[model samples]
Target: MAGQIPMTRNGVERLKEELHQLKSQDRPNIIQAIAEARAQGDLSENAEYESAKERQGFIEGRIAEIEAKLSNVQIIDPSVLNADGKCVFGATIELEDLDEEKSFTYQIVGEDEADIKANKISISSPLARALIGKEDGDVVEVETPGGQKTYEITNVSYI
Candidate 1:
């Protein structure tokens, strides 16, 4: 088994929902499809059977993956965190681009919950790594793919 998978409360709930859907709905439906396809005679030339089998493999893989992740999950709730104004796991940070002077907000979250469009950054990301342990008004430089980017921490909040 790998190390613990860090996840937020919402991330765990989302994964649990997906696991439920796969086991209760997708798995059963795929089994039924395979059985129905098998009833149609020859197995070698049955495209439906092949497709169903492939889908079954995918579903089973997903189920196992979700199960493993859940088994090793470390859930964190941002609303209850107390970081004393420092950027840490589950901290929502407000930043100002030093180059462009534009303001942005991002929440540091687990990899599974990170969504750039939603302003949830992964803890392992360059910007998040730079922001970690930094207090409000601290300046941080991140090595982005485009180039080096600088930002000032305008605010830090747990929730």
Candidate 2:
């Protein structure tokens, strides 16, 4: 399906962790807060009760969201992937900026696992798209908002 989301093993684990936190921690805490607020309030004029209810609604919504994602997640472990050294999903790649002459590392991952600050880029990103199917030592030119930039693939690893 067009909406099907692919996730790495780590990404799925992270989602499960968040769901666990929301269920075991946030859910009970909010329910207790609501009970406390209800004991001190008249039905229509209780701001504490209203706020607690709103928070409960948000928590329940997120729990449902996480459950849905887990239900449909396809976990792929990058460490076991071997594409004969060609770049693909779950590849850790090292690149040298042709213009800047600076080296950096990035791992191509699913949308949920993509964190620019952590140097994990989404597979759908322009740079990732350009790098896909490319082998080590290949030069790729990616179009960005700043314009086209060239990068040389220095290394590619599955791990």
Candidate 3:
């Protein structure tokens, strides 16, 4: 497990789904597009063919990247974790900003699963790093691009 990347079960499933789509749908579509473009005209001045080839390269690169990540994934089920009251990987945490009096929730996830829109933070992020091993009611201070911010851990849930 030394080289394995820790990710939630849900994260792994999402990645697998994306990989399936890329391989089964996107790859074939790009191949078809390239073939159609090739049939249209001369290879020397074919804009469509050039664009399709570039897109095909991108799609293949992404497929390789996803496959590599999936192969090295270490899926962790948050529901089955027993980390006591400490914040750990895959733990969903509710935090209250001490200065702004605002509440925020975030799940610690692998780099590939981190999405700010979904309130998921990468485990290696500054805020997650500060929160890890901390318990509810613990105050965490993190330095960000804006400035230093303080948050009090209000709740920590495995799921």
Each candidate structure's TM-score, on Cα atoms with residue i matched to residue i, is 0.94, 0.92, 0.96
Worst ten in a row by lDDT for model 3: 1-10
Clashes found in each candidate (C-alpha, N, C closer than 3 A) = 0, 0, 0
Off-target runs (Cα >4 Å) in candidate 3 are none
Q: What order do candidates take by lDDT, descending?
A: 3, 1, 2
Structure candidate 3, residue pairs in collision: none
Kindly report which residue stretches of model 2 are placed more than 4 angstroms away from their true locations once superposed. Answer: 1-3
Q: Compared with the true structure, what per-residue lDDT tens digits does model 1 show for residues 27-119?
A: 999999999999999999999999999999999999999999999999887678777889998889999999988999999999988999999
lDDT of each residue in 116-138, candidate 3, tens digit only:
99999999999999999999999
List clashing residue pairs in candidate 1.
none
**Each model's C-alpha lDDT?**
0.93, 0.92, 0.94
Q: Considering lDDT, which of the candidate structures 2 and 3 is the better prediction for this target?
A: 3
